[model samples]
Target: MIKEKKVSSRFIYFFGAFGGILFGYDIGVMTGALPFLQQDWNIENAAVIGWITSSIMLGAIIGGALAGQLSDRLGRRKMILIAAVIFVIGSILSGIAPPNGHYFLIAARIFLGMAVGAASALVPAYMSEMAPAHLRGRLSGINQTMIVSGMLLSYIVDYLLSGLPATMAWRLMLTMAAVPALILFFGVLKLPESPRFLIKNNKLDEARRVLSYLRPKETLESEINQIQEAAEQEKLASQNTSWGSLLSSKYRYLLIAGVGVAAFQQFQGANAIFYYIPMIVENATGTAASTALMWPIIQGIILVLGSLLFLVIADKFKRRTLLTLGGTVMGLSFILPAILQKVIPDANPMMIVVFLSIYVAFYSFTWAPLTWVIIGEIFPLMIRGRASGVASSFNWIGSFLVGLMFPIMIATISQEAVFAIFGVICLLGVAFVRIRVPETRGYTLEEIESMEESRQAKQKSALLERAGL
Candidate 1:
């Protein structure tokens, strides 16, 4: 019998969670910074401001698409390095953008989107690959936590710099990203490449070395053996299939489920709130716009706390159950605001803020992190890169649509109507998760793959028998 080996949670946490910080920071930073950017850049209209806010997502759509293919070819570590470079460039360009040309700012936002897209795709994959089976959910959940933490940091930065002139404050906010980017670049360089990547590249010796560092010494050999077996299985599976096979009747359902979950997460209107909470607060409170902007920071703090709660409980509960419950909560949150807005027309500002706060908290606890963890862990390894890209692309596409149209929607319709639409979408999301998504909390990647292979073989055998072959 093979011996079981213990692993260090610290090593996994440090390396895995670092990438998430960037994700969170990027999410939080832009929301607060946008008000200052708009003021400084002379963007007076809401539509233009929305465009400026979403430009990064448009870039991210492209970046996420490229990340999967590139990581598949170049490996995860290298892709992260590339993302860091893009982030630095985007940050610097955004910070120093000339006031005369809005296009420069748009371009810079797009560049940052690319970096975010790449990191979103790669970080989870890397964390999933590195984590021990028992700790996979918790470890992967760290990515989301870091993302929340980053969002919180952005809020703090924006609050502290709220007093600065628009140009200097925005520049300082954007440039601060460089500090983390530098740290991420140098820190990642010191870490070994993923053993899975090494194994796929036919560097068995190097794979073993990396595994030794990743796991306890006693478990290294068994882990290496397991990885090799998995690599061989993946290679064999790839021999007959291409990306086209993802559409085959047998595999198509999984793709739909994966992509649907991803799309719904965005459609639930979480990001609409994220990208425009400052504006939303102003609308609700009739407070001076700058003071209203502090709402995003509140949103960020709640997000961090909610995500932390999810991390503690994620492995303990069924993913589908948690997702459904979260979705329902989110849907209710959206509807409450819409109802209050329509009924009262002039409700208390504190009441509006309280409901919005609850909405943000619900999103953080359930849908935000769970969606990512599910996407990263659900697919078989062979198609993981391509499939994850497809899912992430769908996510970005949904985010793009929401970001692009929310300004127009809010103008044409009311904020109540916009949120009402989101409420409906969240209800649909809850239904989708309830009906389609499977529980995958305790299963190892290897075990999940085995189940898929077994199912496929059984199907193939039945087909052959029916044909009398």
Candidate 2:
């Protein structure tokens, strides 16, 4: 019975990670498909291509802004179901989009962006809420892994379909997401609602029942107690929380920190590579566009492998240390390509591939997964939805900027300069994280919240005493 219960808990977590897989697939599928899209659509300029590429991110920005309020009102499960539906619609529209109607394709991409945005916010929160505290890191990390896996699968699918007729090929690639979207919708049906959502809704008994399925049987009672305590804390905190209150000094710093991390994650040039790999590869190798399209697959593979390796060490290492190291490695990776381009102007294509692969490897293991893990865990539950949404909004905004600008930047500036700029951004990330980000590894969410509140209370009291209030 114990073994069965343990297996059941594992299965639940696996299904939860599946949601992330869909998120990754949606984000990555368009990378390879874009080259074919531009040619088929008769796109003539970098600015136009950039706008088309970033249309989804613009929709995502709106979706992310709305996600918190909707999820809080509708419950995580329901919001995810809605997102799945939107994903299906977007996939179908994109697959059969009018051949010459670029605007229609943009509209479809925008719809898909909305689904991606909602899922991005909800999935990690759901996974974190459902996971046992001790195992939360690993379980949440699985979401990142699944995201990479989905990306890898997208690349493989694109590579395989690359030789097919362009119209059918791109359509098939975009529509492949429907398979995972359907799987996520059905998988979520069987999955229990997040225990936190239930507690927040005043369904304490239901929360406990859900906890039974989420935690191992032996740990169920203790998990329930932890949830009850956290709920009580949240209730007390709620008395002081409102949208307006978040702007005050007490909460302002946390909000800034959250948004900073989110913005920094994207501004570090991760999406530049993700959105423009084929172009980067073409610039580096002087390869034909068709051959350059496969480069993102190499990136996807390295991302999967690196993230898996990171999972092993994440628990053992300090989170800040890992993030710093990742930033440094990423910065160096960017510099190497620039150096090769300058010095060896005629460097081997394989060397360029090797260097780019190393860059992806560094990003996947460290910055990519850890940023989401830390963001999901750091904020208090009472304001988590809003705070996370705010942060995610910044993230998507940065994604939009990078996606919209990278192509133009690469066109105007040398590719070496583009990479050099990213390297500098990464170095700045290391400095910011080292100074501002706190280590939260091995700490429970409740404990972290308590610590933050305690500090806030002390600061508030100090100000009152000074003002003679």
TM-score of each: 0.88, 0.88
Please report how far candidate 2 places residue 412 from its true position, in Å.
1.1
Clashing residue pairs in candidate 1 are: 24-147, 25-150
Question: What lDDT tens digits, residue by residue, belong to model 2 across residues 138-161?
Answer: 865677889889888888888888
C-alpha lDDT of candidate 2 relative to the true structure? 0.80
As a whole number from 0 to 100, the lDDT of residue 339 in candidate 1 is 82
What lDDT tens digits, residue by residue, belong to model 1 across residues 382-426? 677567778988999989888877877887877777887888999
Distance from true position, residue 28, model 2, in Å?
Answer: 0.8
Worst 10 residues of 2 by lDDT: 1-10
Point out where model 1 deviates above 4 Å.
1-12, 380-383, 441-469
Sequence-dependent TM-score of model 1:
0.88
Runs in model 2 lying further than 4 Å from the true structure: 1-7, 214-222, 243-253, 349-351, 380-385, 442-469
